[model samples]
Target: MKRQIVLFFALAMFSACNKSTKSNATQQPTLADYRVGEKWVWKYKGVTTQGEIRSEGEDTREIVSVDGELGMTIGTDTIPVADMVKPDESETPKYDWPLEVGKKWKFENSWTSQDGTKGTQSQDVEVLSFQEETVEAGTFMAYKIQYKGTISNSRGYSADTDEVWWYAPEVKNFIKLTQTQEDFFYEEELIEYSKPQ
Candidate 1:
């Protein structure tokens, strides 16, 4: 259960979300863009090609105050808005800023699971389009970004992964993500979002 919880948060961190369609939107958000009362909710599920359900549930994040600093909740952690707004620190970051259609880049990451098995992910990422996308939560202009890559672990487990993600700038987050890796498949989508107007 703990491992699943961690993976859930990791997925959310790696895949960002939001709902307004500003056709020409660019520029990564800053800490100032967050508000304490803002909240985001998503529904996610993971399964195998064999029809086995690996996981299913909902995830939520909300901005709040912590020690006078703005904090965002994820699983059991409350991360500072300042930290959340910074560009990802990975050498081949998951996201390249000022995202635009036709933009392409490399994305990579290395991780050690709780069992101490090391793994690496290497992928080619492309922003395919900027257009309207609709999910259960609502409709917004979003970027259709795709990733293709391979993931391997020290234990000899490896799989090719292909993913498509839709990021909505008005909501400042990803509205949907679908991933396929070998026999495993995973999807997550935004279901609710609210903030003080």
Candidate 2:
């Protein structure tokens, strides 16, 4: 009888362990919860290749509209929702949805600057960790992601780039970003944020 009781207790403990593992696995955040009117303000600083400070200022983006996706207004540019957050099998996702730790992907993109300069970029991104971080905006849980890759410009400038981003699912936007390239380095951190009433 004692042996049977011990066996039953062991089975019960194993069942509890299984339940706990499943619960933790299902706690990941989803991207569909972001709402309209959500806004984030950031302070940015830049350093030139010559080690000279170039520009430093505050920039803000506000969610002006949301239907199937989110649209943000930054300065005089009104970025379409689709351009900001679309995922596809063939193209790099602007922001990977349903974020999870240890997830990784590769992306490539080409763009032209208003001054007629063209560039191509390819990068591999990985979710490094998830933890609580405090910033000017506030303390919150965030995902830290790292991106490493190379970029080449039509001006015959090619360099390797490394970037890190901190994203908070609750805000539906990245709270901080740091990018380093051969020619320059830039960093931005969220100073303020607001949610729709």
Candidate 3:
């Protein structure tokens, strides 16, 4: 009877441990979790070709609606769902879901500016690594992605751009982004994030 009792308790403890492990494995975020009312605040700085500060300020993006896709309003700009990720209407998704290290993809798109300036851009993106990052918003496990691309305009001018982005799945958006184009530099980091009640 004593041996049987010890065996029964050991089995129960093993079952409990298995259940806890399963729960922790399934807690990671996915693309389907991005929903409306999500908000992100960022602090940004921009530098010009002459190495002078062009702009520095705060910006906020809030998801006001999600129909077939998600839509966010940033400052006075209401970016439609379709325009958020892939501005050029490329078939490749702006963010390849289920991010993994060493993953790589290439996409291209052409666009005409509001002022009628036409251009084409292509980007080669790679997932560099995944690690925990602590920004002003909080600490999160994020995927670090690198983007190397080029843009050419009808005016016979072209520029190369490099961008690094830290995307936290829990936030359903990027927590930090650093970009360099020609002699211009820009950086934005998340200060806060919230989900709608």
Candidate 4:
């Protein structure tokens, strides 16, 4: 009777261990779990090419799908494809593709004026590479990403710039962004973010 009881107890312990292992295995991280529909309020701080320092701009964007389709608004202006200023046949937004490692995307962004006129300005970005890292807060996991890309904003003007982006995820959106372009470096943080009821 004693031997039989010991065997039964050992079997119960083994069953419990197996169940715990399976639960952990099913919790593996996936790209889709964290990189979709992230809204961010971004501010810009950098020097202009004309040697003037400016420190104000707000940017918001939503990745509508995992296939790289995005809706973005910068400073109350939406990017239009119909009227491209200084139409460059080769400028795109970096990360225009899905937010997966080893993936690439480009965006052709143009701006229009409030008066129903097209601004002679647009930006093209190309994503070269992407990487993710972890940061520390009080009791939360912070993810930071880096995007290397090239940009050209020429609208009958000689504004040529190349930049790299460093972004870190906030609670519900992008709270911080850094841009290093040519001879300019700028960083911005979220001042306000809200969802309409």
TM-score of every prediction relative to native: 0.87, 0.74, 0.69, 0.38
Q: 111-190, model 2: which lDDT tens digit per residue?
A: 66656777787889887887898889999777788879987878888889888878765565567777788778888788
TM-score of 1: 0.87
Instruction: Please list the Cα RMSD from the true structure of every candidate, rounded to 1 decimal place.
Output: 3.2, 16.1, 16.9, 20.3
* Model 1 ranges off by over 4 Å: 1-25, 88-91, 114-116
Cα distance off (Å), candidate 4, residue 187 = 2.4
User: How well does candidate 3 match the true structure in TM-score terms?
Assistant: 0.69
Ten-residue segment with the worst summed lDDT in candidate 4?
11-20
Query: Per TM-score, what order, best first?
Result: 1, 2, 3, 4
| Candidate 1 worst ten-residue window by lDDT | 12-21
The candidate that wins on lDDT is 1
Clashing pairs in 2: none
CA lDDT of each candidate? 0.78, 0.62, 0.62, 0.34
Residue 20, model 4, lDDT: 12
List pairs with backbone clashes in candidate 4: 40-174, 92-107, 92-125, 93-107
Off by over 4 Å in 4: 1-43, 48-51, 57-97, 113-155, 167-172, 180-184, 191-197
Model 2 misplaced regions, further than 4 Å: 1-36, 65-70, 82-85, 91-96
